[model samples]
Target: MSSTLLEVTRAAHEEVERLERIIVKDLQNEPATNKDRLFQSHRVRNMIETIMSTTHKLVEIYEDKDSARKDEIAALGGQTATGTNVFSAFYDRLKEIREYHRRHPAARVVDANEEHEALLKEEPVIEFTGEEAFGKYLDMHELYNQFINSKFGVPIEYSAYLDVFSQPHSIPRKLKLTRQYREYMENLLEHLIYFFQRTEPLQDLDRIFSKVTAEFEEQWENDNVQGWEKDVKESGQLPPQHTVIDLDYYSTVEELMEVGPDKLKEALVALGLKSGGTLQQRAERLFLTKDTPLEKLDKKHFAKRSHGSEQNGGAPALKEVDNSKEIALMEAKMKKLCDLLSETIVQTKENVVKKQALTYDEMEAEREEEEMQADTESDDEEQQIYNPLKLPMGWDGKPIPYWLYKLHGLGQEFKCEICGNYSYWGRRAFERHFKEWRHQHGMRCLGIPNTKNFNEITSIEEAKELWKKIQERQGLNKWRPDLEEEYEDREGNIYNKKTYTDLQRQGLI
Candidate 1:
């Protein structure tokens, strides 16, 4: 239909242009005789006026049709006539309505019998004019202002109607200044304001919304905490205490119980526990301890005398008591320190549990548990000697081998020459030994930095080379200022040569 209208408009335009050309040509070709030229000129002017009137009418008609089409498309909830497939458009709308109904089933029914029944009372009709009309517009503006302010908890002005009024097409063709026309304009303005509000971008609104939401959330949390405390008091139950380690172990145990003995055995074996004997035995070995009374155990008794008397093979003598007050004070201080540490641990555990509750997800929980279990198993296996060449078939039908142990020469007797001839076997045992305080002390004794990278350099030659490279990189052989040059007048104050010289030249120095 639009295409047909466009074709008719094109034809009308062409006809108008043709008439204009003909009128121009006639005026140009007129005879030079005064009377004939005058008559022909008058005729050409009349033709030109008629063509102009016709073109204006055609344009008006085209504009009216275009506006009507735009209205029709808008009424049908379509953006463009050419782009809209009637069937598909209606189908999508229907689907959307169906989905809305599915989500909120109550909106499917319309209640028109009781509450929405025709009211016996007639609504008041108020007319505004002059100042009163202007006052009513102010009232409407105030209402819009209040609506935005109250809804968003922020002040926002409605100026979209101003733009609508500025548009030429917004005014009807047969516009009037009557009461009905004024009412129509008011309604149109109201609609425009609503449309703008509904379609406005929320980028500017985010900060205000976030602040309001945060305040509400904080209040909600406070309320929840109060309610929880109340419930706890009413129930006469203590609040639960939870730690990160406790939660992890609890989850692991729960999963193991759910998966049964077969999986439990597998988990234990993976943890480097002997998988021999029954599943019950493996479970006991992993989770239980032997019950023994203190009285039943073989205990060693120490004499109340000093060992020096025993070594001299002499009769035990009583030692003189000294510094009893100082000893008592030290003991009290130690006790207070222990108490503080325990309190700190409890608070830290509570904080961790609270944080975990906020961010925890069930899927992520499972994945974390798996990773933790793998790490635990790896740590356990890393302490034991294992042959990487003989790989065991994993539960997943893949080869589960200690490849790192073989690669790092951990299965054999390993020694770090830089660490002063210490032999280590097993992956973790060797790595840990290499990174120990004693090993670091040994490296320091050798006048080298105790970096972990040196642990990989097992041979003396490689260690020497690494130490030499480190020394060169650190510029240990570079020229440096003496103590006097580094520190001028101030005791225990060190500086670069230039800074020291500058300070020394100053009168204060």
Candidate 2:
């Protein structure tokens, strides 16, 4: 009896997964002194990888030839072996791509319908009604009131529409409250996904996340974890702090900010001020509130969640909206995309976030890629010899020219204080980094505007002084209505507002 092709494929896939796992988990790390085993894992892994690659290549070539032959036959008005219509199938597949994009508007379909110019030129049909599209906008007027109300004991911090979006399977079916004790920051991340997507902050965040991922992976490699992704969650907790930020302890807000955004935010939270903003904003908020009476500090920031009724005996405010199925379906797709984004935050053991395939078909294709190829690449990298100096890799996967590296001053490292002391390799990278997201982000946190005037001013103190001087100069130049503007009196005498008022009061006009 012969096994079906699908059954054979499934068996082969399972065997591949098992073999790869054993090679990685069992044999890969055997000590070099184990002469009995002779450390044959590398050789065994390489040999298996070669066989897999060759087999897959041969199979692909055969399939390609077979498909081309059938296409040729169909194009020449002949029948295919399996009675398949290749020409029709090709266009049908293209149409399927078009239809998929139409159904899932937010899936980020790129190079879409670009297989043919005529199809690409065709405008996509707009399905959402004008009223529906208009209605979809967030009602800020009502939303702020809901936030102020903090309805259903949900803390306002994690109650935003976008925050609700990223938590998975949260649309169309119906909304449900978990009511589990989360300190408004149940998750490590407190900001919106949009904030995390910002370049500078993302880079800053990447460092924090990279450290966390490394530690988790090390634990996983040691067989301390049962599943791969159970620990892929954010802590949202601030970095550890030593002391309370105080006016007596620190002379300037710049001095107070030496503790970093984490500490600054903690101080802001303690002071009952808005804790969200760049590092600079938090420090400023803390310093400004230092002299204020405790009662004057924002109470809204720490407002307790209300149940069915507000403490004032007012019922929770509601914004009534009539939803159409089309709008609901659109929202469902959007919610699914958001859910998938949070679901697919896997790290590749390197510090990089693994790029997720955007569509189901692409994801299926990615899953089908041979696992051995990755192992083979890793093995090949280990076996190859390289430069002793450990220079940067070039576009062709070799150490870049030593002179080119020297010319660019790549050997030297520059650290930007504004960028949380993130180091940039080479003078070009260092200079360029000042203008990039990380440095600019650091500046933004300090409440300093990123401009040429502040360029190369990485010292927080210097930035504060320059910002103060700029503000002073701006104030001097600013038009004062009472002093600067001249008013013509009935006697044809031009007088400033103060002079004109004095003359009118004295009856001297």
Candidate 3:
């Protein structure tokens, strides 16, 4: 037993090490800026810490049990627990090494270009042929691949999309566009499909449904017992009081057909949609029936059953006209909706392109100015003052610029006071940080009294003040109930209390 436990413990330790390698490699591509790097480091720390803690607990339990079992084994025979002792000793040393590594900071992380530069120094370059549009396709493919790769830690290679486009089903049929457009569309679809496949698993859907039911049952078992009992009493498991018909009779098509059209007509007559005229006259009346009720026959069911009436050879002309008009009206509404949606999409795309063009111009201008400054500085030794503007602090003797301090403050201003990180990427991140915090804290603090300018923070002082206020409000060290209550209110307002509260305090809520 001791030896078996030792082997299991060793295996678990090895497994965690393997998992850690994968996690670290995945995070290598993340940006190494103040907030982003801080966040990535924190995330990696959390993952490693979790792995370490779990490993520790498992080792501790195994050792305790193994020692007791060894004593039992000693009583039984002369054989010693060498394997158990060796594994325990090894795990202890490994844990100590890991702890030391945790205490000592690692080398600073660098950007993707820097990392790629280091890699490309040894590797030979490959060449490819391309048309004019091929460049655009390649660019789009690379961008899409990068986005997915960074996000999900999944490799969606350019070759994979090329393979997809080469498939007979896609190339000769649906995506029969120019080669460049086909490849681009394939790449886009590849990303969408990859994400969808990752999210949607192949396990029995009923199992998920069962788990949901089990969770609901577990949650409501104690607290809602009396209510549940009352509900069961009021609504018994037997057939509903309104369900008077025999279910067995309705189960088979043969049984329904055996009832005959005459019997069905008589049943409908009993329900008050009968005409004073004969069966032919009633069929004619029912054809045009819209608001008329046949108590047990739903209007939808009546319309469906009326399809059989067409074969019965009555009111064929009336039925054809009704179906045609309904189809025509539906087609007209669909066309109008399509036009409206297309117009909205065109305007939205125009706005986005305009905004992107302006941003690109600004970035280009800044780059040119930076290049000019760099050239001038290289020419003159006196003006060698490195503008450590957006650079990380503690790089050189040059003191950290005022803007970085301001940016850090702005990043903090938007970061979750509870989580100490940005909520998500893109839109959700913006909504949580800028709209939620800045709006609540007072728009004047962000210097955007009326406008929605979240990306731009006005000054270093305002940013610093906001950051300080957030810390105070969150009661990081100081336990202020008033501020805590404010956090609670904001959490509720955003419909995200669980996200706002830490895990330890989550149970209390």
Highest TM-score scorer = 2
Best by lDDT: 2
Query: Per-prediction TM-score, please?
Result: 0.17, 0.23, 0.20
Q: Report the C-alpha lDDT of model 1 over 1-509, residue by residue, as the tens digit.
A: 12334445676776677666655555466465533443454455455667778788677865776586455445356445577566776776678667766877665343433321221111222233332231122223443443333311124334432222223222221122223433443453454333222222212334544554565456444643111112222211112221001123533334434445765554443322344556555544434312322233232211123234547664422221122222222222323322323443344345444545664344444444565456557756445433234444457443343443245555477777766777876566777876778777777776777776686766667777888887788796666665435553556676767777777788646
Clashes of each: 0, 7, 0
Model 2: per-residue Cα lDDT over 146-234, one tens digit each? 43343222444322433443333322111111122122222213322332332112134445445645654575456452212122112
Which of candidates 2 and 3 is the stronger one according to lDDT? 2
For each candidate, what is the lDDT?
A: 0.45, 0.49, 0.42
Alpha carbon lDDT at 395, candidate 3:
70
- Structure candidate 3, residue pairs in collision: none
Stretches of candidate 1 above 4 Å error? Answer: 1-411, 476-509
* Global Cα lDDT for candidate 2: 0.49
lDDT for residue 473 in candidate 2, whole number 0-100: 91
Q: What are the RMSDs of all candidates, in order? A: 42.0, 30.1, 37.3
